[model samples]
Target chain A: MNKDYLNSDIKFNKEVFKTPENYFDNVKEQIYAKTIENKDGQMQSRVALWTIVKPQLSLVASFAIIFFIALFVIDKTKEITPILGTADTSSYIYTIEEGFLKTNFIDFIDPSDSSNYREEIPQDQLAEYIKDNIDIITIALLD
Target chain B: MTDRDIIDGLMNNGNRDHLFRLIVDKFSERLYWHVRKMVVYHEDANDILQNTFIKAWRSLDSFRGESGLYTWLYRIATNESLTFLKRDKIKTFFSFTDSYKNVEDRLNADPYFSGDETQKLLYKAILSLPPKQRAVFKMRYFDDMKYEEISEVLNTSVGALKASYHHAYQKIQKIIEDSV
Candidate 1:
């Protein structure tokens, strides 16, 4: 092979190849669009700290509210005294009049009388009574 | 704008996009031809060019003033072309096919190839060299790039690149003469 012959005979042209019309015009736009799309996707997929903490904060706030309401209701119930005023029983015919019962109950119950005997209900009967009276009011007060 | 002006604009957060567009507009054609000569297809060249610019955009922040912007861009474009060729070669290997034959077929059948028989022969002869040698030959012979500039793009010593180009030239001459 003759290097001189090859060099003289062959001519290399860079302009031999062609591209589609307006190819370069759109390349920058295409790349820019791709970058923007990637950025948008990243933003959409990102999890904000507030998004996660907001639900947890709301849950804690709800629990605190419930606790404070329960405390208020319990305090109100404790402040209520049992009704012990005398009652007019002339218009009401009953097996036990309120005034008579109150007067007798006060006389019968002596806190200092240790020798007084009182019958206690059986454990099973007391358990049955507790189960039957278990309602929202009892649950709320207990909570 | 000058390379320094472009670099300064890129450093400024406000002017980055406009300056990058300027960079792309300025270098795209040169880089495209450089890649197209190696890849031998318009679409493949376009892909390589896009990859080159994307890589540049991603790493623009780390670009210090150590090398000229043109040299940096050329380096990126060259690496992308080589990587594309490597991937293509791997694919061809896995498929039990000849990589050079595939490129030859593309070169012959490509609609955009308007070269005469002699030019076609020259291209075939050039492609016959190893990939790195082909790049060196194309840069020196066709691009008319100096050995120093080619060295910067390839990250190789100028002496080694000159030797590679000389060898590539001899090989291309022999191939062309044999084909003739």
Candidate 2:
């Protein structure tokens, strides 16, 4: 076992071991089988389409429900109710004119005189005003 | 087939399994011996070799041809063997007086080990070195691998590997000379 002797002897024995009979063949199959088993396990563990999409579907449904509820609440709040037991002709007419003017024109100009711009006009005053307002009808008839 | 051909086949969906089988058939023996020399037991070497291929199969898509396929495989095999040795060392630390004594006993009792007295002595000398140096010596001496290739597998510089192999050789020579 001298150093030089050992070095020389090492060159003599290129291969000095043994394995089981047909080890290469058996090991290849063993490795393939193991790989196949792992592949199958991986496939089994994959996330399904339903699993991924279910949460997204739920989120969309929740958003839709919230949007509809908001719309319903807004519509209910926007409903106009007339004051009970009162013939409020001027106020009702003003509300309808305001809505029509908002929808039809960018700017509104009131033609009524500022002194006559009353919030509440009595039903009698309205009837008298309609009876006396013959000039617009006469002009239309003449045309 | 060439390494590139094997890699191309592995990248293909239809031929991946077949090419992987070819890879196993072609390189298993070389990797087995490489791992066997490090662990010194057939069963341990067998486990390490299997783990190496399984790891290669799992990571084949990410290989990117950064190194030769065989070199990459060798890197995996070497790492698996070294990891096995480290784990075994930790176990021996808790249970035995000396880690190499356990390996020597395993070597002596291993049914697959049929080396003569001189070969056994040589193996013992090699095993007495630290695991990393032992790896360098095994790859350089037994496998006839170049320092550059060993560098790729161990991630050490060629100069460092050469120095490690030289130190391993001197220690092994001294051990064998003393046992004479």
Candidate 3:
């Protein structure tokens, strides 16, 4: 019985495979090159995806900007008004003229004079006196 | 990257350099032999080796980490080698010119191939077995893989693989006896 196996004459695979000279470096570089190529592709898609999405997002952002502008304009329009400012003593005084107390409302300006608000008139009567003066001034302006 | 991470990343189109390097640096020569054992030529092994890597890259996404990455890769390479062998067998079986004749011509030129009678008888005996049986024999004998490892790589049972190897060895012994 001839037990033919790795004949002593068989001349291959007697040892482990070895890397030839310069082959290991080539393998490493190839690995690196493939990696860089994959990363560059990922960066490109990120840029591309951002470009496609930004314009749509910008339209909604523009709408928010306009709403803030409208709010600021409405606030500014309510801010500056002669009636909302301090009263003008030159245009108003506690004048008893022919049973009439005259005081201007729309054109009132602030006064630095302490004589303008005297303790002689109660606050309840002050409204009636100022309203009567306003009517008299309105007639003068009309005339 | 850890080998698993690198393999996962590569499969998912993420950075694969570390894992792939490990793969090439570690398995290239071994894979070359695996392919070479079947095709029996340097150029053929080179072709199959590149293809196995490319196939691994393309299919990495489906890998579920169910098996060790090395075994998974070995599985792919082994299957590729067997597929090549089967294709060659079909072509040789059909064409009267015979594919082994071309292999014989190439092997005759190989300075490493021995021309002794016992080696010739052993070679012929290996040829007489079916492709799968020959594969089991080679994986078991030449690669010296355990039955469990062979099963992991071949997707065959250790019992079945053991049986196939036994039958192949017996056939070789019988063939050698007849030739003598």
Candidate 4:
């Protein structure tokens, strides 16, 4: 039966709300006790948690560091190593021997004496000539 | 005691509990009303206010005094109230209940809510607003907080808060007119 109920304008008045007697005091005391208890509990839990987790974390970190170092070492080894297989290496050696025979042996024979020297030497004959002229022990040692 | 005195006392490990009692003395009532206006239930407001203080105690190390002590506490209270409302809304939704009706019933039943019919209807209108807008309106209209202070507490731009308050005012005015 308030007049404001009929009026269009309902003024904002905060005094209408109420609280229980001594609620603030009761709450203050409650908050103080609760916070103190909570602080002690929290400190204990933090210390316990760190004690449980510290070693595990350290172990994980150690493993991670070791794993990275292993990866780095393997990568460097790959860089220094040649990629050729054994068969491919022998073929490469034959190619160099053929070039050496063509340039040093065949060309060194007097070209004016065409009958004594041929345009190309067979690989077997070249191997025999190198074996007879170059000491096999000295060649192996140099290699 | 001044805020600086309280902060200095709290900074020391030995005086922290005693100083915190002073803080509770200073802010509990003001913060309780701020929360009560939002949630409209004394019990809920009580819970939120306690939570605000507890949170402040836990995070004391982080309070660098960059803002006023009351401003910081207000921010915490506002956040707790909003979170409670959102959580309560979800609970009401899942329970297949109308949150508005529930508040209205509680408002009528609560001995603490001494408002007459007109005040009750005004609260209903206020409740109809979105949570943030409700906060803005209550802080501005009831608490008479400045727009700048509200901005700090709500972390909103002053212009936006002004606009929001205007919209909230118009909406409540319309609701009252229609009821009449």
Q: What are the chain B TM-scores of all models? A: 0.90, 0.91, 0.79, 0.92
Runs with alpha carbons beyond 4 Å of true place in candidate 3: A1-143, B1-14, B98-102, B111-121
As for TM-score, the candidate ahead, 1 or 3, is 1
Per-residue lDDT tens digits for candidate 4, residues A1-143, read 33333234566556788888988888887787668656741211112434545666688899999999999999987765655435566676788877843344644677677584564667787876777667864777899
- How would you encode candidate 1's per-residue C-alpha lDDT over A36-71 as one tens digit per residue? 334331111223445545666788899999999999
Chain A fold similarity by TM-score, each prediction: 0.29, 0.29, 0.29, 0.34
Tens digits of lDDT, candidate 3, A92-120: 43244345556443334345656755554
Q: What DockQ do the predictions score, one after another?
A: 0.13, 0.16, 0.02, 0.21
The per-model lDDT (C-alpha) reads: 0.73, 0.75, 0.62, 0.78
C-alpha lDDT of candidate 3 relative to the true structure: 0.62
Which candidate wins on TM-score? 2
For model 2, state the Cα shift of residue A46 in Å: 25
Off by over 4 Å in 2: A12-15, A40-143
Give the residue spans of candidate 4 off by over 4 A: A1-9, A40-143, B12-14
* lDDT, candidate 1, at A138: 95
Reference-based TM-score of each model: 0.63, 0.64, 0.53, 0.63
Q: Per-residue CA lDDT of candidate 4, range B1-180, in tens?
A: 899878766656537767777778898988988899998888888888888888888887788777778888999999999987766655555555686788788888998888878788889888778889989998898788999988988889999999999999888877777776
Best by lDDT: 4
Displacement of residue B59 (Cα, Å) in model 3 is 1.1
For model 3, what is the alpha-carbon lDDT of residue B50?
Answer: 59
Q: Compared with the true structure, what per-residue lDDT tens digits does model 2 show for residues B1-180? A: 888888766656547777888888889998888888887778888888988998888887787776778888988999988877766655555453676676689789888887887788888887677779889988888778888878877889998998998888888888777777
Worst 10 residues of 3 chain A by lDDT: A40-49
Which residue pairs show collisions in model 2?
A: none
Interface RMS for model 3: 13.1
Decide which is better by DockQ, 2 or 4: 4
